[model samples]
Target: MNMATNTPLTDEQSTEAAIQRAGKTAPRVTLMDIEAVVTSEFYFTASDGVFGASNYRPISDRSGVALGLLTFCVLVLRNGFTVTGESACASPENFDAQIGCDIARKNAREKVWALEGYLLKQRLHVVE
Candidate 1:
């Protein structure tokens, strides 16, 4: 009778082995851990779009381009997963380009925070 040949590895063991193969020491990670590794940033314009529009690129005085309404996008990526946040912002009465960029980036981060919260809840539910 060969127990090793007859027995199958448990789910936890399998998962841990996979993680080890991936070079990660831990088999499981909490939501906070995911959030810590998760990153979010804004892009001011897109390459193939208008001359100077979108979040991946913005028109500026340096380029002799008139400053106009700017659209920005927040891209969040983690462990092969991606999420996006988008915003259109303008230089207001007192706000400058830097300020507008800050606001846009903040908005995107909020979106990512909400998504992370939802994911955390789902993971917690499954564990219980």
Candidate 2:
């Protein structure tokens, strides 16, 4: 019995309805696809000495004691939305700026996935 109409639904009717629902286009996202959507990007850190391919930023005290390294990546999507990610290294010996930036950008990109997923779900709901 159909809950809404309280009518007896045959097996064929149920299968046909399920097949029809399955036919609706499903949305998907991939990391590579997300990456391509980024139009402009930049980075930030406490120190600029390692802003090269490694993208490392070092944080130190007034006494110039090496503390840690931090990397930040900001991604701006084609839609004008912005996302941010950060990477941190507690040991100065592990100074790798590029890795930090990559990590931060990845964190930021994760947010984009959530946002895009919600929008897609909303659109699908309307279609239903």
Candidate 3:
């Protein structure tokens, strides 16, 4: 996890520290931290689309798309109004599944942003 050196809200850090002390395990990973990594990578790669060479295969009704790689399976849903992402992996011993889901959702949201821009221009008759 490429986490930032600066801590987040004091309350979050306190809670995480408490959880770690109680469990005697590695520092807990928060969803916010995971999203930060995903967003960072999204811009780091200059938005060449998320998940390199990963393609989206539409499911029935074209409401969702599935991406399968190695031991991971990610599902992204875009229904013209909302977007959602979820992932599952063969191994339950790690955080790959959750990270995959986060990346997938970020990828779908970028696509939606592009669509929104296009629609805006269409409505306003703005040239590209």
Candidate 4:
């Protein structure tokens, strides 16, 4: 904690904390493990091409190009399974491709955790 601000120090504010918490309950999934399962990753936008791009790009005085700023990530895993994730920006001024990709990747990785967790549980006979 920082005495000056009376706030907890967030030096270790990361996914590792969540992984540690999961360990307390049963078998757990780590981010690295999740990442290992991903064989390929593709990132795109609503206006990337052909389909959605044909429609009007919505706009607003405050958000500018916000409506068309939806970002998506499609992750192909080792076993031929695929998962998708998405991120959206409320304000175009704050939109960033890298940030969107990071968020979308994290979102997709979360689904892998769920899937892999279930598979592990089943293999361990922890659930019926």
lDDT of each: 0.54, 0.70, 0.42, 0.76
Off by over 4 Å in 3: 1-95, 126-128
Q: Which sections of candidate 4 miss by over 4 Å?
A: 1-26, 49-67, 126-128
Which residue window of length 10 is worst by lDDT in model 1?
Answer: 62-71
Q: What does the lDDT come to for candidate 3?
A: 0.42
lDDT (tens digit, per residue) of candidate 1 on 1-128: 22678778644357556777889853344334545755765565332245445434444553323233444655566654555444444433553556556656656656666766687688878988
lDDT of 2 by residue, 1-128 (tens): 79999999755457556766788444655455676789999987645534353565443553222323666778899899888877777776776878878778778877887877787788889999
Question: Residue pairs in steric clash, candidate 3?
Answer: none
CA-only RMSD, every prediction: 14.9, 13.9, 16.2, 6.0
The whole-model C-alpha lDDT of candidate 2 against the native structure comes to 0.70
Going through the candidates in the order shown, the clash numbers are 10, 7, 0, 0
TM-score of each: 0.47, 0.62, 0.30, 0.68
Q: Estimate, for each residue in 86-113, the C-alpha lDDT of model 3 and write its tens digit.
A: 3334443453544765565555555544
Stretches off by above 4 angstroms in model 2 are 1-25, 48-68
**How many residue pairs of model 4 clash at the backbone?**
0
Better of 3 and 4 by TM-score: 4
